[model samples]
Target: MATTYRPPRLIIIPGLHDSGPAHWQSWLQSQFRDARRVQQRDFSQPELQRWADRIASTVDHAGPGEWLAVAHSFGTLALARYLDEHADTPIRQALLVAPAEPDKFGLAELLPQQRLRIPCTLIASQNDPWMTPHSAQRWARRWGASYSNLGRVGHINSESGFGPFPLAKRWVEVALARAAREQRPLHASFREWSFAI
Candidate 1:
């Protein structure tokens, strides 16, 4: 008898204003066969509770199999909050890029202060106005997530010229490969593809 392997579903959680068509997140979604983007009701508003609730709703309807999430900017904050509130989550691993500072939205105390149980990688940039690199590293530590600094890429969004980013694609591929090899929940071990970025 042979066993079947299903790749983790991709959950694309974009930021406050939503990822534009040219944004890397959008490009990442296009590369995956089983991918779903979380749609916020109002992209212009910064309602933390509503945003976090949307994340939960999206996950609830994600069907079957574990999920690998890629969230950017304010979406990272909402994802963190969702993970904090829901201990038993379907999200096996996450790639949180250019996370906006919780303090900027007056939500520092609302999000998880302790380490997150699920494995994640947090990529930061030296010149991202939304969050300082130091703050990004600190939050990575707080969430028990691996951290990477991308030098001076601004916010790692469309404005940063990050359309069709190969690194993001490679990261998801490596994660799915690792999950298949382990035959367990997905874990974040990005050392193999660190040089590819």
Candidate 2:
């Protein structure tokens, strides 16, 4: 017999300015009816604590089933902080793309210093101004997340011409398949799974 794979509830978490209509995150939300973006009260200048709180509350309200958190740029830091604080969070997997350097905005001290327990994939660009490719890879290792390097993709945003990133959608599918196979709580080393795009 064959098994059906029901896609997890997607929680779209955009970066500093929030994904505009032309952003890939916005296009992703439109593609999936069940997916929704976590709204932040202030997008102009986000405070770490506030963003973390909002992400936590949104995940909590989504109830129990599987949840796939799609976070980009600074939103990745917010998600990391939430995971660090709440050990038993409901998120099953996460696709963290173009994570902005927390240290750049003086937020390094506020974020978690340890590895995340959830299965996560960190997609980064070689020439992202917010974070260097080396730093992004290091952070992924520190967080126990699988890393993918998209060479010179310029932060992987709308300005980089990523309004409809089909590659990201494919990666999401891969993450979901891995989650289904693992079944148990994720706590494995992800370094061995690193790849390039």
Candidate 3:
């Protein structure tokens, strides 16, 4: 008997204050019925440990399937922490966008210093107030993720006019399609584009 293939499930991790209905994360979730967004009890207070715990809990209860995470801003840091702590995580690939500076929250020492185990893509903007493009690139190197510069998009949020981000949708679709075709764990880079700044 041939075994059936199960596609990777998407786990959406929004940033501080949560992604509003008009935010790209919301739009992404609306597009995928299998996607689940992480819900923090107190979005106002960004306690790293608490946020990481929320991610773990979500993953633990997410049932059986491979996971692909899409995280933004502070949520990106939380997802990194979760990945670092859990070496046996079900997550195969991740797309981190506009990650907030770890030093800003005094979390530089708390996060993993080595490259992450799984494949990842880190997206940064030239004019994001939360993190500089240089800092984003450095972190991407540390995380062993491919870095992509969006150029001058402020934080890549709704206020930055990123409603229904088609690029993000494309990234997810490509990843899913590749995994479905291969019928194995994704060990390849998902970098669609990268530019020197």
Q: Give the TM-scores of the predictions, in the order they appear.
A: 0.91, 0.86, 0.92
Model 3 per-residue lDDT tens digits across residues 10-58:
9999989999999999999898989999999998888898999999999
Each prediction's RMSD over C-alphas, in Å, is 3.4, 4.2, 3.3
What is the per-residue lDDT of model 2 for residues 1-197, given as tens digits with 9 covering 90 to 100? 95565657788999998999999999888877788789999877768889999998887787666678899999999999988988888787788999999888898888777678787789999899999999899899999888889898898999999999887777666666665655434633333233234
The all-Cα superposition gives candidate 1 an RMSD in Å to the true structure of 3.4
Cα misplacement distance, residue 36 of candidate 3 (Å): 0.2
Q: Estimate the overall C-alpha local distance difference test score of candidate 1.
A: 0.88
Residue 21 C-alpha lDDT in model 2: 94
| Ten residues in sequence with the least summed lDDT for candidate 1 | 188-197
Can you rank all candidates by TM-score, best first? Answer: 3, 1, 2
* Reference-based lDDT, each prediction: 0.88, 0.83, 0.90
Tell me the spans in candidate 2 whose CA falls farther than 4 Å from its real position.
1-7, 179-197
Model 2: lDDT equals 0.83
Tens digits of per-residue lDDT for model 1 on 71-139? Answer: 999999989988888888988888999999888889999889988868889999999999999999999
Clashes of each: 0, 0, 0
- Name the lDDT of candidate 3: 0.90
Q: What range of 10 consecutive residues in model 3 has the weakest lDDT sum?
A: 188-197
For TM-score, the strongest prediction is 3
